[model samples]
Target chain A: MKRFAFFPGCLIPARYPAMEFAIRQVLPRLGIEIVDLEGSSCCPDPIYFKSKDKLSWLAVAARNLSLAEDLGLDVVTNCSGCTATLSEAIHLLEDDILKKKVNDRLGRIGREYKGTTRVRHIATVVRDEVGYERVRESVVRPLEGLKVAIHYGCHLLKPSKIMQVDNPDNPQVMERLVEALGATAIRHRNWYLCCGKACQTEDIPMNMMHDLLTTVKAAETDILGMICPTCFSQFDYGQMKISKKFDEVFDIPPVYYFQLLAFAQGIPYEKLGFDSQRFKPECLLRF
Target chain B: MPEDADRDEPVRVNFRFRRELAQKIEGNLASFCYQCGACVGDCPATTYSSGFNPREIMLKVLYGLEDELLGSESVLWQCTNCYNCHERCPQEVKPVEVIISLKNMLAARGIYPEVVSKIIGTFETTGRTVRITSAIDRQRAKFGLPPLPPVPMDEVRILLEPDTGTDEEE
Candidate 1:
């Protein structure tokens, strides 16, 4: 089994423990071992903390990277935001000057960044490391008739040069993954839009979420498949608020792609944490 | 010539300040922005709120209207940090990075969204953005998950300290 240090970030551990359960249940069966990233802090939230203090942001992200560096393994995160922040920090710290500055802060804590560790989102790990054919072969049960709309959350794809996860404009990797599990991945309008988690404080996030959900509803997909925990929260929990606000019932369930994978891998549905979801994925039970 | 003319024309641009802000950005990507509106067309925030245009933020940065951009309640937070602007920019303007730099400047003065302040405060204390309530712990245990590992909060505090020689605290 290929061992990796798991970086679960803040949300999955604190807010969405079910998602973590899904990841833990699924990855090991696929021959991947997850080692807990002990002593890790928040990705410090790239957008919020980076805007507040870039140096502090770098320090925190570097600190998290060092955990995996100490393990002599690359870090893999389930949250796309964590992957983005950590990857961006690695890119920034590549410069000797920036590395020295961040390292100087880290030195206070008796930690040093050797600049050796790399970060990967779980999607990239499954895509590149576990070949598609292997995923197809591993499937115990296929989601033959289910139609899934993949939400490739923003940070997973963009700032294209830095992320390098997939083609930014025409991304089919997630859709392709959906297909590998024997589901029809539908291409929907505004599927490329951000889940609007960052814009939640203001009215715009709701407006944006409403737009994306409307398009998904119009497409008539059974569920929205995504990788990031933040997107999962916004689409899964936020759906109720959006439905109430807009006075339209959007019963579409938002599910992590991994949860679906575990289900398709024939992991018991009860262990996958389907009971905790706000909008229970009853539609998926049919398969 | 006329009284209306004096009132109608806005004050002259602060060329020096504009150049200073532009220089502060690494690689001078801000100066590279030629305003083709590629970022505007692709920006999700712009599609929702007409007031949240990124190209306009770039234009404001170019014009040295720091107060206008930073003082505005909506624009900066509206950006989901999607990076479509950076990806599609023909000149590699990287409008998102410029906006982040501006936010950094504002945050140095202790100016930013209240939500950001609240979240960062929690992170500084607990080494996690959200506290691990008893209920959450119960849920983790119920799922056959191990207890959360401890965080080195003391080390986190030291790392979060304002680096010496920077008056960010003041």
Candidate 2:
């Protein structure tokens, strides 16, 4: 089994532990082992924290990467925000001057970032580390006839020069993975539109979500599949708020991709923690 | 006309703010933005909000309008930081990075939204953006997952410590 250090960012553990649970349940079955990176903090958040202080953000992110570097393992993150922060930090720290500056701060704690570790979103880990054919073979319960719409939340594919996960404009990584589970992946009209979780303005996120959900609803998909817990929270919990505000009934459940994969791998529905979600993917239970 | 008279005066670009921002982001990427409106086309914030526009923000950055960009009612908060502009910009201006640098400047001036301050406080103290509680462990147990581990605050604190004059040397 290929072993990788797991960096479950703040959101999945705090607000959405089930996603973490799903990841733990699924990855091992696909011949991938997850090693927990204990004592790691938040990716220091990609938006607010980075906007507040770039140098400090880089320091915090570098500290997280340093933990993985000590283990001699590349980090796999469940949240796109964490991946973006850590990946972008590595990209910036490539400069010897910046690395030395961040190292100066890290040196205070007896830790140093040697830039030896690589950070990847779990989606890519599954795609690149474990081939899709292996995923197809591991599935005991196929999601036949289910239509899944993908939300490749911004951080996963953007700043394409740094992320290099897939084609940012027309990404098919999630779609192919969805198909591997025997489900059809539909790319909605506003598939490229961000989930807007980082937008602090109230009306801006609300309207942007309304626009994206409108397209998803029009596509008539069973559930929205996304890789980021932030986007998952926005669509699952925020969907209820958007529904009431827009006077439109958007009942489409948002399922994290790992949860879907776990379900496909024959992990019992009760074990996945769908009950705790505001918008439960009850449709998956029918299979 | 008053508008024409106003235009006649020299537009004084704040070189100090521009130079400071250049130090934060490599190459001062905002200098390369030619205002082709590519970043504006796919911007969700610009699409939904009338006041938030990346192209206009880049124009301000080029002119070094620090007061307007970092004012009390700054529109930078409206940005989603999706990096779509990074993908769309032909010149690789990375408007999102420039906007983030501008936000950092706002924060350095002790000017930012209350929510940002609260998050920063939580992260500094707990080493995580979200506070952990006994209930969080309870939630983790429900899925047969291990209890969440404590963050190394000693190290996080060191990393978060306010710089003591070393940053300006570069």
lDDT of 2: 0.88
lDDT of 2 by residue, B40-152 (tens): 98998888999989999999888787777889989999999899899999998989999898888888789999988898889888888899999988988887777778888
Instruction: DockQ for candidate 2, please give it.
Output: 0.78
> What's the chain B TM-score of candidate 2?
0.90
Provide the overall lDDT of each model, using Cα atoms, as 2-decimal numbers.
0.82, 0.88
Q: Model 1, B27: alpha-carbon shift in Å?
A: 9.7
Estimate the TM-score of every prediction: 0.93, 0.96
Off by over 4 Å in 2: B1-7, B167-170
* Candidate 1 residue runs with Cα over 4 Å from true position: B1-28, B72-74, B166-170
Worst 10 residues of 1 chain A by lDDT: A195-204
Candidate 2 structure quality by residue, lDDT tens digits, A160-219: 889989999788899999999999999989988888888887999998899999999999
Which ten contiguous residues of candidate 2 chain B have the minimum total lDDT?
A: B1-10
